[model samples]
Target: MMTQNLLVELLVEELPPKSLKQLGDSFARLLAASLEMQGLMSKDAPVTAFATPRRLAVHIGNVAAQAADKAVTQKLMPVKVGLDAQGQATPPLLKKLASLGADASVVPQLKRALDGKTETLFWDSIATGISLTDGVQKALQEAITQLPIPKVMTYQLADGWQSVNFVRPVHALAALHGADIVSVNILGLQAGRETQGHRFAAKINPIVLHNADSYAQQLSTEGAVIAGFAERRAEITRQLTSAAAQEQLTLIDDDALLDEVTALVEHPNVLVGTFGAAFLQVPQECLILTMKANQKYFPLLDAQGKLANKFLLVSNIRPIDSAQVIAGNERVVRSRLADAKFFFDQDRKKTLASRVPELNRVVYHNKLGTLGERSKRVLTIAKAIGLELGGEALANQADQAANLAKADLLTEMVGEFPELQGIMGNYYARHDGFSEPIAQAIEDHYKPRFAGDALPRNPVGVCVALADKLETLVGLFGIQQMPTGDKDPFALRRHALGVIRILIEKELRLSLDMLLKQAKDAFAAQLIKENDFIFDLKIFIFDRLDSISREQGYRPQEIEAVLSFLPPYLIQVPRRLEAVRAFSDLPEAASLAAAYKRIHNILEKDMKKGPMPGVGSVRNLFIDIHFLMEPAEILLFNALNTIKPQADEAFEAGQYTQSLQLLAALKEPVDAFFDSVMVYTDDANLRANRLNLLTLLRDAMNRVADLSKLAVN
Candidate 1:
C-alpha cells in the first residue's frame, strides 16, 4: 500500500514557443492517464506540469511502486467448441488451456456464461500487477510519442551515427520516484536526477534535484529557472505591470504575445526600452504589431490608449547593471521601427485609389481569378445590397468602397504586414482627402474579421462586408471546393458565419438565399453551371445560423421549431424564437403542442390514404358545421374563428409573442374536441370536414413556430 510522488523531466534545446504550453499539458496528462490505466496511480492523483524554454517536466503525487493484482475472467470459447457432447474436455480445450499456462486438471474449474445465443466457457486467473518501473517507462514512452508537437526535428545524437526525431534535440531525461531514480531510457537518454537550467544564470552547471517534490523549488534556487510555465508567466506579468507603472504607461494586453514570450524565456526580467518618438507618426497598429510579432515585446500605451514610444522587454537573464540589456533592445527596436516608418512613408506617396489597377496582377485563387476580378464582383454585390438597403446615394458609396477595399494589398505597409490590410486602406484613403464615410467603409468592410468582432459601422460598410464575405463563400462553393469536416482551407465556414452574423446582428432586411444567388450571379462567368449547389450553399449558411442560435442559449426544440418554417427573414428569427419560448411557458402549452402534433399526424395519414373524391387538397377543405354532430366540434370551430383574427392582427403588428399568446384560448376547446369528436367517421364528408378543421388548427398554431416540435411536457 506504500506510495511515492514521482517527477519526470525532458531537457532539450528550446521548444517551439507557440506549442510549449500544449506540449507540457499533453505530456503531463498522457503520463498520468497511462499510469492510472495501469493501476500504478489513483485516478485523482495530483499532478503538476512544468515547462520552460529548455525543459518539460511533471510531478505526480501518490504514484504506487506497483499496481494491484486484478482478477480477470476471459471467455475461452463456446461450451460446445471447448467440450464434447459428454461435457468433457476436447483436444481443442486442452490446447487453449496449455496456451494459457494451464493443464486439463483445471478444465472442470472453468466458468460457463451465456454469450450471444450460446453458453461460453471462461477462464479465471489473477493478473500479476505491473511494477512501477515498467509502468512508468511505458507511460513515459506513450507521453513522449503522443505530444502535440507542431513539428519534429531529426538530429544526430552525441554518438554521431544515430539520429532521433523529437520536437528538439534530447539532451537529458530525468525520472524520480520520491528520492530514488526510476531507471528508464527515452530518446537515447538515460534517466537521471540532474537537469540543465537557464543557459547563463544557473547557480550550478547541472542542478541536482534532491527529490521528486523538491524539483521545482531547487530549479528556482540553484538552477535560476522558474520551471512552471504559468508561474513564470505570472512573474513576467507582475514585472511588466510594475515597470509600466514606473513609466506612467500601460502595457498592451495580448494573451497570445504574452504566452509566446513566456515560452521564449525561463527567468523573465521585464525591462523598459524606448524607440524614437517619430515612429509614432505611423499608425499605432503597425508599430504595435512589429513590437509584438517581430520583436516579442509588449508595447506600452499612453493614457489615451495611443502607442507610447517606450515598450517593455522580457529578458532571459537578470543582471546587476541592466542598462546594456535595455539599450540593446531599444537599438534593435529602433531599426524595426525605422523599417515600419519607411514603409508607411513610401506607401503614403501613392494613394490607395491609384493602387487599384495593380490588383489585376495579383491572383486570388486559380479558379476564382485575380483580386481585381474579385473586387469587381464584390463591388457589384455591394452596390446591389446597398440599393436594396437604402437608395442611390448609399449604393454609390458602397460601390466606391468595394472598388478600393483591396487597394491596400499593394501598399508597402500592408504588403509587409498583411494583418493591417483594411486599416492601411482607411489611412491611405483619408490621406487622399476622401470623405470620412468612404474611408471608414474601406476599413469597416472587414470589420468582423473574427468571431465576436465588430460589425460594419455604416450602411455602406455593411453592404461591402456582406459582399466581401458572400463573394468568398459563393465563389469557393461554385468551384465545388465546399468545406467538408474541418478542411475549409479557404475559410468558407467563417465567411458563412460572418454573413449570418451580419444579417442577424445588423438586422439587415436581406434574404440569405437571395444573397447567395447574387453572389453566385456575380461569379457566373467562372462558376460551373450547377443547379443544386446553391441550395447546398444555403444549407451551409443555415447550419452556421443553427450553431449561432444554440450558442445564444435557445432550447434545441425551440430552435428547430422556428427554423422548420425557413422564415424568409433571418432577422426575425430571434423574435420568432422569443415568441416560441414565451408560448412554451404558458399554462396550456403542453396540451396545445401535443394536439398540434396529433393534428399534423392525422392530416398526413389522411393524405397518404388519397384525397376525398371532389377535394382538390385534403388540407384545404371547408369545415361544415352541419357535419359537426358534436357540440365540442362546433365550440372548437368557434374558438378557432374567434382567435384567428386577433392572432393575425398581432402578428401583422410585429407582436410575435402576443400572436402566440392569443392562440392559447383554443387549448380548452381543442382538448375537448379531440376527446369527444370521432374525427375519422365513416362518412367521407364528415372526415373531410374534420380534416379541414384540424388543418386550420395546424396553420394557426404554426404562425410563430411549428409548435409540434416543442416538448409537450
Candidate 2:
C-alpha cells in the first residue's frame, strides 16, 4: 500500500481567531468522514490543523492512493407479478438488466419455517462504475464547499463564485494528494498545485507542493507561515522564556493571552521591553491585565518579589530599529494603566456603604422587575431555605448579603468590566461595615456560571446561591420562558447544576418539594398571564434534575420512575437509582420484572387504558382460606406475608434495593400462581382473593421502582 500524504490550505484574510480554530477542526473531521463513508481506506493519523491570522491548513498522512472500488446493490422487481403467465423469466426485466450491463439472475426463495408458505424474488441490478479520480474530486468538493462557515458573505459579485465567504477574501486554494494536484472548481476559484507565500514577507508565485511533509517544510522556509499551532506555540514560549531569563525576570504564564498572541502573528519574534518605575505603583493585577490585554505583552516579575518595570512582547517581524517596537509597547501599556488607576482612585472616594441604597434603581431583569425587587425576593427566599436546611448562620448571612449583592453592578469599575460583578460587590460590602461572612456571600453566590467555574465556598454563600438560581428558574417558569433543545438563553442548566452540587456535596437536609413551591410563590406576583400554568413547574424542574442526576451516576429511566411516585423531584436522583439498584439484586427480582413485563405487555398489546384497580390501602395481606385451593396459591399466600414485614423495614431504612431483593424471592411462587391459579377466574371469591394478592405484589414492586415500566435494555 502506497502512503499517499495530502495537504489542503485555504488562504484568506485574517479570520476571527476562535471561529477559525473551529473551522479548521471541522475541515479535518468532515474530510475524514467523507472519505470513510465513500469506502476509502486510510491509516488514521493525527490530523494536524493550523491557523494563522490569515490562513488555515490541514495535513493528513497515509491516505490511500485511491478509494476502494464500490460494489452497488439494488432490489429489482419482477416484470410480471408471478414471473409472467408463461411461468418463465420476463423478457422486459432481462432487457433492462442487459442495457444496464448486468446479467439477470434468479434469486432464491424458501419456505417459511413457521408454516409452509412459499415466495420467490429476482434482482436485475445496475452500477455506474466511478473512476477513482472522479470520486475523489467529487468528495473533496463537497467537503470544502459545505464546510460550516456560519455568517458568510458574498465577494466579487461574480458568476460561479462561492456561496460561502469568510472574513477575508480566499485568495488561493492549495491542495495536493501525493504528487498529484487535487483539482477542484469551487465558486469562481480554481484549486491547483500553485500557492503563494506570506502577504508581507517573501511574496512569491506558485510554489508547487511535492508532498505533505515536504509541503510543510517548503511553507516554513518560503511560504513564511508556521503549519502547526502546537509547534508555533512551543517556539513562542521558548523564545519568550529564554529572553526573559536574560533579564533576570520570570514571564507571567497566561495561556489565554498566549493563544490570542499566537493567532496574531505568522512568525513570532520575542522582544523584552522596559517601563519606568513610576508606573510600578499601579496594582499588580491591573498592571498584568494592562500588559496582556492592551499591549498583547507578557509581563515579567523580578526575583526581588516586586513588579518588574518590564514586559515581554511577541512581534511578527524584527523592527528596522529594535528599540522602536520595545518603546511603542511600553507607551501603550502605560496609557492603559493610567485609565485603571483613575477608575481605582475614583471608586475609593465613595465607600461601598454609600452606594448600597442606590442599588434599588438598577434593573436585574426587565421581566423580574427591579434589582431592588429581586434583592427583596432573594432575602425572603434565602431565609426560608436556610431555616428549612437548619442553618441559622447561613439564613442570617443570606438576609444580610442579598440586600447588597448587586450594588456593584452600578459601580464604575464593574460597568467598565462586567467580569468583576461579584468581586466589586464583595469589596463594597466590606466597606459598608458588613461582617466578613456576609461580605463574602455577595461574591460567592454567583459562582459556577460555567462548567469550569467554582462553587460558593460557605454555608451562607450556598443558601444565597440557591436563592439566586431558584429565583431565575421560578421566574422564567412563571413567564413561560423555558429552555428547550439547545436554546438556553438564561443559563437555567447551570443554575440547576449548582443546586445539585450543593445538595450532594454539602449534604443539605432541605426538601425540594417545599423549596420549589416557595420559589414559585415568591415570584408568582410578577407573572402577567398563564396564571393557571403553575402546576407545570414540577416538569420543568424535574427535567433539569434528570439531566443533572444522570451525570451523577443515576440511570435516567430509574430517575423517571422514582420521580413518578415522589413529588417535587428534589431528592438525590442517585439515591433513588441506588434503591432501584439494590432491589434488582434479589433472587426473585428478575421474576418480578419478568412478571410485570408480561402484565404490561399484555395490557399494552390490547391497548388497555385508564388506571386499573390495586389493593387499595391494605398494608397487610389476607390469607382468604375459603378461596385458597391450589398448593402454589396457599404457599404464595404465606410467602408474601412473611416478605412484606421484612421488606417494609428495609425500605424505610433506605435499604430499598435489599427490600427488592427480599421481595424478588417470591418469583417462583409468583410464576406458579400465574401458571396455575387464574387471576380473572369465574369464581368471584377466588377472583377477589387473587386480586388482593396482585395488589399486594404491585405495591411491593412499586416500592423499589415501577418494574412494569422498566425497559429491559
Candidate 3:
C-alpha cells in the first residue's frame, strides 16, 4: 500500500482578500467530489484544505499512490428492442447519446425474463478499467470547471480552447501528486509542480513545489501570508497588546471592526502610531470612528485615562520606513476626526426632542413611508410591551425612547456611519437631559444585532427592541414582503430569532398569540384595503412564530398538534420539548412503543374498510362480577381505567410526557388483552366494552405525538 499527496495553487496578482475564504471552501468541496468520482481519493484517505488571500492550497493525505483505474456500467439495449424487432435500431433512443452527450454506440447484449415471458433486453456492460493518469485528469478538469469564483477572467489563447471559460486571466496553474506533477490543462494554463508566495515579503522568485507536501510554508514565506483568518487575527491582537503596554495603554478590540479588517488583509503587520494630542479634544466616538473606519486602526486610551490620540494599525506591507507610513495614516485620520467633532458640536446645538420632526425629512423606505411615521408606529407597539411587563415607569419610558430612537438618523455623525443609527440618539438624548435609562435604551434598541450579538440588558431597552422588531415584521408582512426560504431580504428571520431569544433567555412568560395580535393591531388601520378578516392578518405573523418554534428545537408537527386545541403559549413549547426528551429516558418507553406499535397495527389493518368496531360506554355486563370471567381481563380494564384520568390530569397540569408515561404504564395490560382474548366475541356488549378501552388507549397516545411517525431506533 502506498500513500500520496496532491497540492494545487493559483498564483495570481493580488486576489481580493474578502472573497478568498468562501472560494477556498468551494474549491475543496468541488475537488473532493470530482476525485471521489474518479477513484483517486481512497476510502482511507483524508483531505486537508487551507487558504490565504493570495493563494488557495490543498493537501490529500494517505491518497492512493495512483488513482484506481476507472470503470462504470454502461447499459445498451438488446438487438430486439434496439431494432424494434425489425433488425433496425429504435429511432428515438439511438438518436440519444452518452452521459456527456456523445453519439451512442452498440456493444455486447443479453436477454432474461421471468417464467417463460417475453423479456426486454440490454447490453449489460461491465466497463473495463482505463489508465490511472486518464482518471485523475478527467477529475481535475471537472473540479476546476465547477470551482466557485466571484470574479474570473481568461487571457490565454482563447479561441481554440475546448475547455471551460473563466472570469480571471489565467497566468499559471500548479498541481502535484506526491512529488510528480499531474498532466492536465486548466483554462489555458498548464498544471505543473511549482507555486508562488507572498507578493512582498518573500523571494521575488516563485517557489518550485517538488511535491504537494511542501505547499504551505513556501507560499506563506513568499506572500508573507497567514493560512487561517483566526490565526492571523490572534497574532495581531497579541502584538497590539504588547505595543500598547509600552505607554500604559490598551487596545479596544471591536469585533465588528476586526471582521472587516480580517477580510481586508492577508499578511498583517502591526505598528503603533499617534495623532496630535490636541485632536484628543474631539468626542471619543469621533476619534474612534475616524481611526477604526477610515484607517482600519484600533484606538487606545492613554495612561491619564483620556482618548490617548494613539492607534494601532495592521498593514499588508512591511515598511523599511515604518515611521513615514505611520505619520501618513495619522494625518488622514486627524482630518476626518476634526470634521466629526465639528458635526457633533453643531448637531448638539439642537435638542434631541426638537430633532424628532426632522426625521420626516428622511426616507425610511420609498414604499413604506417616512422615518417619522415608522417611529410613531414603534412607539405605539412599545407601550403595549411595557404594559405586558407591568412596569408603568418602563411603559412611559418606552414611549419616550421610541419617539427619540430615530432622532440620530437626522444627525451628520449617523449619516456618515449608518451603523451608528441608534447609537448617536442615545448620546444626544443624554445631552438633551433625558434620564439615564431612556438615554441608554436608545442605543440598546438595536441589540441582538446578529446571531452571536448581545441582547438588550435593560428592561426599558428590551421593551423598545420588542416594539422595533414587531413593527418591521407587521409592516413588511402586511405588504407581502415576508421572507421565503433563503430570501429574507427584510431579515425577518433575524427579527423572529431575536424575539425567541429575548423570551427564552429572559424567561418571560407570555402568550405568543397575544404578542402576534399586538403586531396585527399595529397594522389594523393599514389593512383595511386588504381584508376585513383576522385570519389573513394573523397567519403571516403566526407563520413566523411557527418558523421560530422549529428553530427553538420543537418539531413543527408537535407545535401544530399542540396548537390545534390549545392557546398559543410560547413558554409551554419548550417545557413540552423538555418533557418529550425526558420521556425517552424512561425504562418503560421501549415497552410502551412496542405495545402501541402492535395494537395500532391491528386497528390500521382490520378496522378501516368494512366495519369499525369500538368499545363504547356500556360497562353494565362487565359491571357484574361473573362477567369479569377472566382475571387477566379484569386486571387490564382496571389498569387502563386508572391511567386514563391520570393522563388527563397530567396534561391539564402541562406535564405532557408525564401524561404519556401514565398512559404508557397501560402497555403491559394492552399486550395481555390482545394476547388472551378475541375481540369479536359472540357477546356484542363485551366486545364493545373492549373496543372502547382500545379507543381510549389510541386517544391518549395522540397527546404526545403521532406514535407511528416515530422510529424506535
Best by TM-score: 1
How close is every model to the real structure, measured as TM-score? 0.96, 0.77, 0.75
For candidate 1, the per-residue lDDT at 171 reads 93
Taking all chains together, the TM-score of candidate 1 against the true structure is 0.96
lDDT tens per residue, model 1, 144-170: 889888888999988899998999998
State the number of backbone clashes in model 2. 6
- The lDDT of each candidate is 0.89, 0.69, 0.69
RMSD of 1: 2.1
**What TM-score number comes out for model 2?**
0.77
lDDT by residue (tens digit), candidate 3, 1-713: 46577776665555555565666667666776666665667655676667555556567765554554334444444445555554555665465434424344552233343323544434344453433456556766676677776767645455664444554455677878788877766666788876655566766456787578767666566546676556776777777778889868977868767656765667778888877777765567767877777778889986656678778888877878888878887788778777888888888998888889987887877666888888888888888888888678778988999899888888888888787777788888888999888988899888888877888878888888888987887677667676777898888778877776777677677666677667667654744235433354345445656676677777554556444444455556566655555655677666666666665776665465544333343322233334445656777778867887888888888788788767667767767777887765777556655555555676677665555434263
Q: What is the lDDT of candidate 1?
A: 0.89
In candidate 2, list every pair of residues with a backbone clash.
160-187, 582-657, 583-657, 586-661, 588-664, 589-664
Please report, as a residue range, the 10-residue window in candidate 2 with the lowest summed lDDT: 107-116
- Best-first order by lDDT: 1, 2, 3
* Best first by TM-score, ranked: 1, 2, 3
